[model samples]
Target: MKIKRAFIGLSVLCAIMLCSCSRTPGGIAPAGSPNGQASSQLPTATPASGSSDLSQSSRPDASTATSPAKPPALTQESIQIKLKQMTANEKIGQMVLAGIDGTTMNAQTKALIQDYQAGGIIFYKVNLANTRQATELINSLKDTNSRNSTPLWLSLDEEGGRVSRLPDELHKFPTNAVIGQANNEKFSFAAGSTIGLELRAYGLNMDFAPVLDINSNPNNPVIGNRSFGANAKVVSRLGVQTMNGLQSQSIVSVVKHFPGHGDTSIDSHIDLPVVQHDLNRLRSLELVPFAEAIKNKADAVMVAHILLPKIDATNPASFSKTIITGILRKELGFQGLVISDDMTMGAIATNYELGEAAVKAVLAGVDVILVGHEYEKEVKVILALRQAVKDKRISMDQLNTSVTRILTLKSKYGISDQKITEPNVAKLNAEVDKVMKLIQ
Candidate 1:
């Protein structure tokens, strides 16, 4: 698989990054102060909850350089313009994802986060906690970006049902496939609207929602009910409805596992699945919903870790340029974010080294690499990416193209304008009842 000539132009037109020099916020910090400095001496303060008293703490004496310097003023518009001036290498680094936990920040994660300058953060099961715990953890991470005065696109797989990270107390909706089976559009819209509201209220910017994979094979281990139905039209209608409801609340929607993973019996999480179908077969059976989503302006597309012998003999979707740029970008004309499903999983874990996949992924035209769980892994991936650009294995031009897409998603999600806030877990719980009723 080759990065075509057209791919080169993506770097110049959209790829970009920004250098943040302030006390880079959003790394691992304690509940209150990032460095664990005494709360009595907070430099600048933002309330975590609505009822909390909002007031600036007393200023520190000038002699106390230990005091927080004034929070550098950062607005979303300013960051976008600054990113445009960045180098391609920096831009590529910005698109890598380093998974993070709430309670503690590892030095390795911190270093990768600071240096790689990843575009977004995704939370996993291990990373979750109670509302207070989540609020503090995300707040601390957001602080690092705030120090740079750049808002980070904090993301989560709060899809409700089996995949919810934050629990029912924190909000969880019924699975989409469940909702879709109900054959009620109002029920679908309500469920989707609630999911959108809960996500945004938490300061999270994106949802890997409304799974477009049609679940054509009931025996398919990974994507069974994750899809709405066996029929493409039914899935498309529900997926688009879910996408619309989510975007209506300004929460960015990602229709995923793209080019489609519906009929395969193999589970990608355990091993890479190969779909041996021709282009026509894909368009008619699997690509139906994804094609509609691309036309509908879905903000991002999550590349599944499956391999398709028909599309490319060697590379899986994540590392394949043909799947991303050729089919999705060139053929479908999707000009949005391209993020990989977590590279930490066995499918990728069993095949390539983490860093190897990271570098190849960016070069493959993915806007971001999702690496959850290990910080050392994230760092290794980052350093590897940096070295590839240094060694000219992954061109600076290639890196820039992906970065541009990353920033555009951030700008569209409203992350730049809003601070990460505590999500309304209780409200999410109320919707779960509504969703369960419809799905049931």
Candidate 2:
């Protein structure tokens, strides 16, 4: 009777071991099995606090089970996966950067986020009242976009001096000209970093600033104080420093009016400004700062509405393939985002229809169209882009390429739809004061 009992006990122990070996840990099905979609179906559990035994924790009998390894975030493969998941409208929406109408969330602005799926919003003085109001407005916008697949680029022309957009509460720093006048790389970088910190405190991700344009034309209306100064080397060095400063604080610095807007006598905002400089002049003078910024890995470039008769006679730089694709992309080897200046501006609106201009801008290799005014015009541009895709005026390959660049940039900056907390005005101002002293 004792021998038989020992035999049965040994057999039961063997059976138990077989069952344990057959069952997969964490209830995950074996690979290629009918229920083996572990990546999507399985729930990952965390080990208990202070638990140090990873091997024991991974045991089938443990209270918590480890998760399968996930693919690295924001990889090229990962971005491509996301790109494949997006719809046509979603892709087109990522190419637009619209303007909001008020200081608070309005119905029209809400639609732009929810219905139109605009990729970004540029704030003007009218959209901001105070630091608290601006933070709340930005947070609300971010909250509303929480359901979006991608984050919005809350941006503005915070170039300081006359182009300043921050409310009365924030410390207004000197313009690019003042920083350029100082001609100190360290000061320029600190100035950019402070501006970036200020923008961050308000939850802004993009600044259309650190004007790379050289102030070659004293009589130039729009870019006089905005430019860093008339010297190419100084502009190049300081512009790049400022660009690096903003980038250091995780703010995207979009070096603007590419191919040089410094020498134009007229404002592109009011009308098409014509630059008579040829390729050689542009390379030597106008393109110097931009080229320097590009070398330092600039995130985005805002194309100007100025027309270079020598480069492309029929089209402005914003809608010329030769300028955007050939000059900026091919010749300069810029692999970053290409943003067009607001299409609703006088330069574009006065000449081409809003819809047609947007389409042409995309065809010219512009990635994001800034429609900074009018809900009707913004909607028109989006619809026009959609129709263009359908009619093949903008091919799917081309559309995907632009959207890929946009997503890659957004990912690179670690942009999120998650709302940020209200800024600490006192604390931020104290930080800005330190930077102010450096430049002063």
Candidate 3:
């Protein structure tokens, strides 16, 4: 009887040891072949806090488990310190991307840069003569702000289909529609890179190309071929690819007409176009491309002057706090620059005074106030923005945020290796020819 009891006790001890070896310390089965079944399919007991068996993803209560810590690359602390050192005028100036009358640096252009201390300059067809003249003209404009820490954003709408400010002497690239029709994102990227190389060669840092708008509506006036395609997925893929290509060549790619200008028949240049779609409709179709661009770290986004009644009925997107701040910045998670469409456009300029529009834009979370084709209006915009700040209408924090983004962009792509001189048109044209081969 004593021998039998000792054997029975040893058997029980072995059973306990085997059971314990199969389970984790928390009394849960190990994460594989629990009960001879796949661990993934079998529901297991919740792991206790600080349990080694639980993976970072499996821990329900862990804060750092679901999301890993992101590096502080674009920290606001350094930008905030720089913002504090800037003068009120400098802050206001950084918010303006002004347009000049002539290709050559005339007195008006001089004042816009030297006196007004404008942050950027956008060139138009009237400002272009030839490649050589364009290069010389851009160089002269750049020289005005050589002393300033942030160089002016020498930009132009070279979207390559219907919109192009580069003289005809330069090789012409295909439109977004042609690229989109190819149904290959690599082609779009090549197009952007080819155009970017030519633009950079001319000493132009910013190219307002790769229009993110979807060509959903065939009858749309201003953005037909300028858009990628009618499909949101295609637009999203091509837009991001093109933007990446432009930025790769050190060109500041400014994707334009945000919140979808594809379906609008009425051009904002003539009058304010309104979108009656609710937030759901926009998210499904229009906002898709913009979201992708934001996800891919686009350098800048230009807000449209159109109004979305469901989003913000009172103000156009460029001047709507609900759209820019609440939607674009907060919901969409776009931390880069938010540039306003030309304030002189008939959408806002015809409906509201330029000065008031500028103030409203700043308050609405616009970083750069684009006053194209009107120097007087640009001056008024600068003054009104400054006055708004002084009167506590626009917070200093808001102003700082805009200036910080502008400064950050300038710091990244502002410095060019190409000297500001007469550009080699033959070499640039040769590069453009090679880039155009993708579409051919």
Q: Output the number of the lDDT-best candidate.
A: 2
Ranking by lDDT: 2, 3, 1
| TM-score of structure candidate 3 | 0.81
Stretches of candidate 2 off by over 4 Å are: 1-73
Taking every candidate in turn, the Cα RMSD to the unseen true structure, in Å, is 11.1, 13.8, 20.4
Please tell me which predicted candidate would have the highest TM-score against the true structure: 2
Task: Give per-residue CA lDDT, model 3, range 1-440, as digits (tens).
Answer: 33233323432443354343222211112222212321111011211111122233221221111111111122244445445656788889989999899768899888988788788899999899887788778877766665343457788999887788988887777778888898766666666666766676677778876798988889898899888889899988888877876775557788888888998989999999988888899889999989988878787899999989888888899989998898898999998898898888889868888899889888888899999977788888999988899999998888887888786665445342123556566766666676566556
Q: Model 1, 69-170: lDDT tens per residue?
A: 232232344334445556555576677766775455655546555566666688776776567666777666665554332346667776657887764465
- Candidate 2 residue-wise lDDT, 349-427, digit = tens: 7888899999999999999999999998999999999999999999999999999888777655656544556766666
Please state the error at residue 152 of candidate 3 in Å.
0.9
TM-score for candidate 1 = 0.78
Candidate ranking (TM-score, best to worst) = 2, 3, 1
